[model samples]
Target: MQLSVLDQSVAVTGRTEDASIRETLTLARHCEALGYRRFWVSEHHSHPTIVGSAPEVLMAAIAATTSRIRVGSAGVMLPHYAALKVAEQFRVLEAIAPGRIDLGVGRAPGSDMRTARLLSSDPRQSADNFPIQVRELQAWLAGVDLPEGHPGRGVTANPMGPSAPEMWMLGSSDYGAQLAAHYGLPYAFAYFITDGQGAGQALDLYRANYRPSPRHPAPQAVLCVWALAADTEAEAWHHFSGRERWKIDRNRGALAALPSPEEVALRPYTPAEQMEADKLRANAFVGSGPQVAAKLRALANTLEVEELVVITWAHDPAARRRSYELLAREFF
Candidate 1:
């Protein structure tokens, strides 16, 4: 079982008015040393909670710092960027990192509708054009032939990779499945979101309708689970509790310093709030090493995914690193 580790570089702090931007590049080295398979960052805009606004830029930094582990964006919101530009940007990164880049693409803005509109107001070519955008990116990456002397011909694309970045379809819906099959690309489902559908049902749909392409014939699947681990189940929950508060507050439109896991479990919640937390966070894995391992194992058992991708965050840097280390020891 490959334990794929990834982070979104959320704001982590206990007291600062604003979460300082901690350099996760150094942390990526630790992740590599700890034997994580990948270190992926996510892109978000105008959010107080996350600091990963430019994931490709961050991935390049991490790639330069570490020689082995795969690095990439959990996904770049494709609708807001040009396929040609993204192809060029990643091709350049691939030139540096070579075999280490993984390009996960998504259609989400990672923000609300107002922000989404502000990011890309072009009505003619925006979110609704996801399929076209993906196809364009695929063509650009594969270096598909263009009309003679076409401007698109000079894109200098490389579809396959040692240095070439592998492409992944990321989504919370069946929409991603269709695109992955159509492009014959590997698909990574956000278990964080699809828990509403049950992993088996979505995984079943993805596998059954998959089309074999030169890039992927086996219908590769990845499941994303939130994880936190510690020495003892109690200690793990203790550590995870604070982070849960971070989530709870974020969901409730309240924002402040990141919470320690211990803070979450030790704190009291109203009955309504506790139920809300449970419903909102049913997909997350928060416990001691063994406890987290069991939760992850059950998710894998149910999803039967090809890879288990852990998507987690912390408010405190030390706690964050320890959490990942504990998870690696038990689950990886």
Candidate 2:
């Protein structure tokens, strides 16, 4: 099995953005030493808790910091930028680190509508043209000519290299899965966000409708999930509590920085909030080292996926790093 990481550079309640980003670099090195295959950063906009608004820039930093781990985006939101620009940016990355970059693209805005407008001139129009944009991006990356009379037929993304970055389509729903299958691209399902529901159906649909292309001759799938591990089950839950509260805040449209475990423990929760938290907890794999390994194995078996991209959310950097350390020791 191949294990990878998806880091959002989440801000701790009392830490600076710089501290969060520094920890990201440190975690990249840590995961690389632990034998992780890939290190992917996420893209978010106007989110107080998330500092990873520009995944390509952060990916470059991670690539510069670590030598072995493949660095890429969990996804760059395709609706916010020109397809040629996206291809050019990733081409430059591939030039710097050949055969070690992945370009994961998504159709969603990655933010609220207001922020989407800030990032894109015509947010709705851009989203409506997602499929067309994806085709153009593929053409640019492959250095092939678009169809006759296409807008980008003659234009080329300069500095096209010998190889293009491996491309993957990221999605939380079956729409994305079908689209990815149509393009013959690898698909990554956001099991963490969907709480593991409907994943089987989506993956099944992807495989059933997949068509072979030069970029991906066979169907490939990856499950991106939330996970945490520690020496004891109690310690693991202690770290997970903060993330639970953060999820509740997100549900309530309150995007606060991640609270400390100690802070979460002292708060009084109503029955409704507690119920919501319980539901949110279902999405995470949190336990002692052995228990987490067993659960992950079971999930992989059930989903029929060989690759896992783990996202660990914790208030303290040490706890987050420890979680990965324990999991790596258990799994690798």
Candidate 3:
């Protein structure tokens, strides 16, 4: 199995949010050294917990700093921006790193409707035109002629080079799967987003309906999963305490930065909250390196995917790095 990374530049308590961005860059370089396949960042706008609002900018930085690992967005929210502009931005990135860019696009608004409206040229613009946008974005990225009667028939996204960014359709639902299948693009299911719900169905739909393209003759699928690993199972669970508390609090409308595990240990959970926490813990991939790696292998095999993009969060950036290091030791 090929293990990749999806770093969201998570903000931790008592640290500046900008620090999270820097940490993401540092982690990308670290992952590259550890022999990971790709280092993908996420796009989330006006989000308190997730600060990676600009994935294209961050991808450029990562592409400049890392020589081998593939760099991409997981992904750029298509409805928020013009396809031509996104194509141009990624074209510039391809110019920077050549064959290492992956342009993952999605239909969902990465933020609240107010922020989505602010991001759009038309405040009323919804995701209804996502398919059209993806078609145009793909054409522009590859410097192909737009179809007849298209508004961008003659325009080209320039600095067109020897290579173009590989496109991947990303989602937590079947909509992205079907769209990706229709376009013959790679599909990545956000297993971490829905905590594995609907993942099997989405992947099955993608493979069953896939239309072969020149770039991809066969269906390609990826799972973006959340996992953490440490020296021991107990230690791993301790490190996961912060994310667990954050998840529960997030459900209760508290979007605070990740608290330290030490701080989490002191808080008391109600019976219902404790049950919820237990459910999350049971579902989580937290343990020693071998234990977590075993689960990762099982999940990849069960999902019938060769690539698993691991995304980990911890109050301490060191712990996050260690998590990746441990997994790399097992898988790489």
lDDT (Cα atoms) of all candidates against the true structure: 0.75, 0.90, 0.94
Error of 1 at 17 (Å): 9.5
**Which candidate do you rate higher for lDDT, 1 or 2?**
2
* Most TM-score-accurate candidate: 3
How do the residues 1-332 of candidate 3 rate in per-residue lDDT, one tens digit apiece? 99999999998889999999999999999999999999999999899999999999999999998899999999999999889999999999999999999999998888888888888887656799999999999899988999899889999998899999999999899899999999999999999999999999999999999999999999999999999999889989999999999999999998988899989979989998999999999899999999999999999989899999999999988889999999999987
lDDT head-to-head 1 vs 3, winner: 3
Poorest stretch of ten by lDDT in candidate 1: 14-23
Prediction 3 TM-score vs. true: 0.99
Q: Estimate each model's TM-score.
A: 0.88, 0.97, 0.99
Please state every model's RMSD to the true fold in angstroms.
3.0, 1.3, 0.8
Candidate 1 stretches with Cα past 4 Å from truth are: 14-21, 121-123, 146-163, 194-198, 255-257, 260-268, 278-284
Error of 2 at 35 (Å): 0.5
Whole-structure CA lDDT of model 2: 0.90
Which residue pairs come into collision in candidate 2? none
